[model samples]
Target: MDRTGKSDSGSSSMTTMGMVFVKAQNTPLYSKAWTPSTTGGYASTCIFLLILAITSRMLLAYRTRLERSWHDKAINRRYIMISGQTEADRERQAVGKGGEKTEVAVLTANGTDERVKVVRSAGRNLEGKPWRFSTDLPRAALFTVDSGVKYLLMLAVMTMNVGYFFSVLAGLFVGELAIGRYTGAGEGHH
Candidate 1:
């Protein structure tokens, strides 16, 4: 009841002070536009959240994979540069019957020298600019999408609807179980 002496019961459930942890249906999730008007609608929303969480995990896994691949390529490029291998020599070696091995001298801790065998393989030339628009642009786009999804999931959890919260938890649990072994520890959250 308000100062006007009129009933406010109709909108009472929709309004709350802050962060009500209640198992409620027909509640607004993220925005008023997503307010579920029926039990089935709420259930559907929960399912959608669950799927979103799983997709987020998948995206994280892909990002990790990309990072590793790029790291390896960078290392390869550095080795090629350090070895002073010319493009013509690299091309000839790559086209030859068997690739040649280069011996690199290593200094040991005890002032001893050791020789390491490095196998050179032909790959994309890394002599160009450090950042290429073709690769960096797509990586940036992927990062933007990944961040957007992560924040959207966070906002959904902030809704404080018990069902929705549990749904997200379940999805994360299931997604981890499915792809956890493939991804590194603590990678999913980021």
Candidate 2:
């Protein structure tokens, strides 16, 4: 009666919205008649995508935290003060160089002055004089490669930017979005 010129209730039908049954083969279009289950398909997809977005964001945050903790343990430290002597003086009291490399005569991390050999060269050479730096292990170590630790904290911000941008994009295109910032990214706080 509506479109095929027959009784409206006279066809093999499928239940749609409002419990109305319509002939699946003869339904003109679905936009006006899609069911709850059909709409829920898209909703469920969105929920799953949201869950995925959140999980990935948390995982990335955990990864960065672990990495930072490891880095902190590496550079947070103590220091040592060593005496200096001539390059050619082997038996002389070379606080840090070529003299009596005393272990207890300097301020240090373990509180014992241990002479550690540090080699710095112009570059790796085939046959150059090996310049060695002998000093008491200093307890003072810079938190970051830079003298200031704020530089190291930039890692946290950069990580946030990458994760945030991707999450926003996912929300817009994939129906998902989740992002989080870390403590290290705090204002003048790291």
Q: How displaced is residue 46 in candidate 1, in Å?
A: 0.3
Q: List the residue pairs that clash in candidate 1.
A: none
lDDT of each: 0.71, 0.36
TM-score of candidate 2 to 2 decimals = 0.29
- The alpha-carbon RMSD values of the candidates against the true structure, listed in the order shown, are 11.6, 18.2
Model 1 clash count equals 0
Worst 10 residues of 2 by lDDT: 134-143
For model 1, the stretches where C-alpha displacement exceeds 4 angstroms are 1-16, 78-129
lDDT of 1 at 100: 37
- Model 1: which ten-residue window has the lowest total lDDT? 112-121
| Number of the predicted model whose TM-score against the real structure is largest | 1
Candidates in order, TM-scores: namely 0.64, 0.29
Off by over 4 Å in 2: 1-37, 77-179, 183-190
